[model samples]
Target: MLGEPSYTMNDLFAQLGLDSSDEAIDAFIEENKLSKDEKLVEADVWSEKQCMFLQEEWKKDAAWAIVIDELNVRMHPTA
Candidate 1:
């Protein structure tokens, strides 16, 4: 039997329908730092669909959760 596919930041970005290139991901992270009180799913940087996808995946603790949590941490440097 095969294990479930692992995900990365690039895959998460692509799933979110955003630019998935390393440089683009880096640029996006640098540009979108969130304050400690800010929430990743509620960030203005995402479209409504993007927000829903993130929130749903996170709530479900799906396979994408690891990458999503990674993104949340990167975005909230103050946290």
Candidate 2:
């Protein structure tokens, strides 16, 4: 039997209304990276709606927060 569905980078992308494919996710991360001082929700790469979602999920430590934090780390490689 299958356990709970796991949330991953692809899931997070889909939640944000982005291309959720592996290739698209890789290309997007490569193309849009955050500087050491930049916050994930404040980055120019996200739309206002996307930013709000991220911020709310993170603040609430919701189920999506884990994947969201992972994305933040990946986006801030310089940090």
Candidate 3:
């Protein structure tokens, strides 16, 4: 039988650019009060929220960039 994928604190810390020390990771986990069994559930929800926020922000920024580029091109047509 195959086992489930597992990640260490170091792997997560490196991915998040956080301190790799046990104390730092432990404090983060405790502050969030994440139980071992519920960790995946909480992380999934958090990931979804972050993805939504980024999508909205990216849409806004892209719209602004397009508008700015159009205005610049109109102001300097031969550039």
Candidate 4:
């Protein structure tokens, strides 16, 4: 039986319409990192498209929500 995954960082990149290459993913992670001083939902860093995708997935609260939420935390690992 299939189950929801704890998506890898590359999986997140692909899902988020980004280059899934290791270098690109690494660069994206480095570039989009929220400071230990900032928060994810409050940050204004995401592009319009990125924000839309995240908001839609979050509203659905379905298949991608867990993965998306995980990605959210990874993107903002602070208060």
Candidate 4, lDDT over the whole model: 0.70
TM per candidate comes to: 0.94, 0.90, 0.35, 0.62
Would you list the C-alpha lDDT of every candidate in the order shown? 0.93, 0.91, 0.44, 0.70
Question: In candidate 4, what are the lDDT values of residues 4-23, reduced to their tens digit?
Answer: 55566677668768898989
- Whole-model lDDT for model 3 versus the true structure? 0.44
How many clashes in each structure?
0, 0, 0, 0
Candidate whose lDDT is highest:
1
Error of 4 at 42 (Å): 5.5
Ranking by TM-score: 1, 2, 4, 3
Clashes of 4: 0
lDDT per residue for candidate 1 within 1-79, as digits (tens), equals 1586789999999999999999999999999999999999989999999999999999988889999999999999888
Q: For model 2, how does the per-residue alpha-carbon lDDT over 4-35 read when each residue is reduced to its tens digit? A: 45689999999899999999999998999989
Ranked by lDDT from best down, the candidates are: 1, 2, 4, 3
lDDT of 4 at 47: 72
Residue 67 of candidate 1: its Cα lDDT?
96
Cα lDDT of model 3 by residue, 20-59, tens digit: 6878765654554433344232344246654354345345
